[model samples]
Target: MSATLKWMWVLAVALATGCGKGATPLPTRLVPTRMPTIAPSPTSTEPGSADSGWVVAARGIEVRNLAVAGVVPDTAAPIYAVRLDPALVRLRVRYAPDTPQLLRTWVAAHHPLVAINGGFFTADNQATALIVADGEAHGASYAGFGGMLAASADGRVWIQALREEPYDPAVRLDQAIQSFPMLVYPGGVVAEISDNGQRARRTAVAMDRAGRLLIIVCPTSAFSLQALATWLASSDLEIDRALNFDGGSSSGLFVDVGDVRWQIDSFTTLPSVLLIEPRTS
Candidate 1:
């Protein structure tokens, strides 16, 4: 089938499976017209320094080999941010139902530069929300969750709250992944906090003002959902929109840049993984 017709078929399936329902409306906040200025790149004359951001806090560390940088924001949590250029990287989803894979396993198999755990799932390792992998829809659009990360055919990334709008498969998207409880909207922080307010390790996907993809992971068990949102909104990362993924024990990030391999493995295996691979011309 032609690529256009294939997307149309997926849209039909998504609509038939009750794509639009039970949507929690996002708060009507004014989106900022001007983009925030990103900090200058790290000032090290090192090889991977071009991809690194300035060290923010005293505890900040630079994994020069992996092109990853860590910062301790005032929120008291360590956030590792890796910037991936859209022109150089291709984003896609990888899933294995019968045999779920770890972040490292997915990296080794696909040989992506970076990989992170995808959206929430059930005990059977099935994704909870709508998922489009390589122009194919794997599940129906779920309205219960509020946020979605979509990659266009041109490799551009867009993050939005599904509560505000449902996923329209008619749009040209190579990969569309959904998650819950949006961390930061376009204007500012607006995450739905739980009554318990327990702190745990958190993972999030965000787009910076410079149109770069940021895969953030908080390895510390000191940030609650509300706290994490506040930190992200106030940080220097200049994040436009952020989505919270299945965190806690499901939080993980793996990067294999050059000969250096850096990984934060999850306690349990994940059902899906979002990978950033080199774009082949």
Candidate 2:
């Protein structure tokens, strides 16, 4: 039998034997007669090419522009592209305004279920938003529980906000959850780990699947959902929804291009996880 055919059979059996949740599809391997090799270029220097601050680890993919940039006061603007790993598909900003109120207004005007209220909250088609949609909890809030897990038009992303208490991993809510760790959004949220191996709870602007914008502003910082929205709309790259995480000393960005990777910013401490930027083509 041909070598290619032999490898195909092996992969087929591997997949056939494994049929359960959270199992990503595997690529069929192929046998080759010749081994691939690349001779080191004479120009290659010794070690320590990169400085002490940043590190480069990803390759092949393209590195686009920075996600955040200065923008006009209040308008829907373009920022940068945030690549969703494993899927090369890019989420461009459909249309986003600045500030929580303006962004909320923009969402309400365009979205089917969006609305505005005292808090300037707005929902997309899913009918979420604490204060936007009618009968929604105007004063809804969350405490201690950190991380931007999921965002839907329903209450899957949010639950009854509680008073600050000790961290609770067993705390449950009635929403489907999706987690993107080490990602930094517009406002200030940084989904990372604390110095003590606990979940880092920061808030910021994040984009949903539909490219809608959402903001999470904590009591700390000069965060004004409305002001941030205004600033974001002025960015050169497009944005959808931008949600905030947490911020303070735990803020940084990492970039990598093949064997060339480094940090864009430095933090006094390492975060639990980091949003890695693979080589952008």
Candidate 3:
């Protein structure tokens, strides 16, 4: 068989046997692939500036612009921060079990102002936690992961650690997306980095003090979960609460603002995505 087919056959066998004889391990930290350097924009603001170790990937209106800034905090690997204004944007979760799509394809089909991989999923690409999209709940709440990002019908967005307060779907939330291991809570960083010390490209969804949503993606396989969380908690981004999403080869972000489109494509297919659309009056 060709190398590609051989690899596929091996993968099929592994999946069929469930990788053999061990408890299905929880998802671990990702190790990132090599990434090309992105040049910083000249007009980026301070703290998020080129001189300050951040490269502005995209910048425009807080709402309409796919504003992204890249930074490497202290000794950690590089990470990108995307800011979305909740007031001017609409947030939704997109998923189709029989029709999993690539991140770029989802962007093209939905034409979102901005989009990111939604959350963690099983090997079959099913969401691992409660998923409420368009005000309808798609799955039962699972406590395996304690962090969630939810939005109300009035355009308010918030992130919560469910360990302290269980997720109540009965609440008046218009949309909700859940992921694992709360990274940064209102009190402080809550994630415990594993000593096994695996690293990979990372992705997170957060809300800042001013209620703007932030989608963070690190394309380079460089940061451990603990390192990423620590940087976010201490950084100047003012993130109020942050939740970790699926990463490694599954992490990606896509944004389109007028004539310019900025994208960091994922190597794997994604079952769901958090989409940002313009608020329709």
Most lDDT-accurate candidate: 3
Tell me the number of clashing residue pairs for each predicted model.
1, 65, 6
For residue 249, model 3's alpha carbon misses the true position, in angstroms, by: 1.1
Model 2 scores a TM of: 0.30
Better of 1 and 2 by TM-score: 1
Candidates in order: C-alpha RMSD to true structure: 11.8, 21.3, 8.2
Candidates 1 and 2 compared by lDDT, better number:
1
Candidate 1 TM-score, true structure as reference: 0.72
* Per-residue lDDT over 1-281 for candidate 1, one digit per residue giving the tens place of the 0 to 100 score: 99557545543332222111121212212111111212223423232234344332111122222222232233333455666667777888876656777666777788877778887665567676778888887766756446888888887788878777777767877897887678888766556655244555667888878776778876545556676787778777788878887765566777655433446776567778898777875
Better of 2 and 3 by TM-score: 3
TM-score of each: 0.72, 0.30, 0.75
Off-target runs (Cα >4 Å) in candidate 3 are 1-76, 258-260
Cα lDDT listed for each candidate: 0.62, 0.26, 0.64
Worst 10 residues of 3 by lDDT: 14-23
Error of 1 at 146 (Å): 1.4
Predicted candidate 2 versus true structure: per-residue lDDT over 40-138, tens digit per residue: 222122121221221112221222322122222232221112233223221111211123222223333343111111111112211111222222222
* TM-score: model 3 vs. ground truth: 0.75
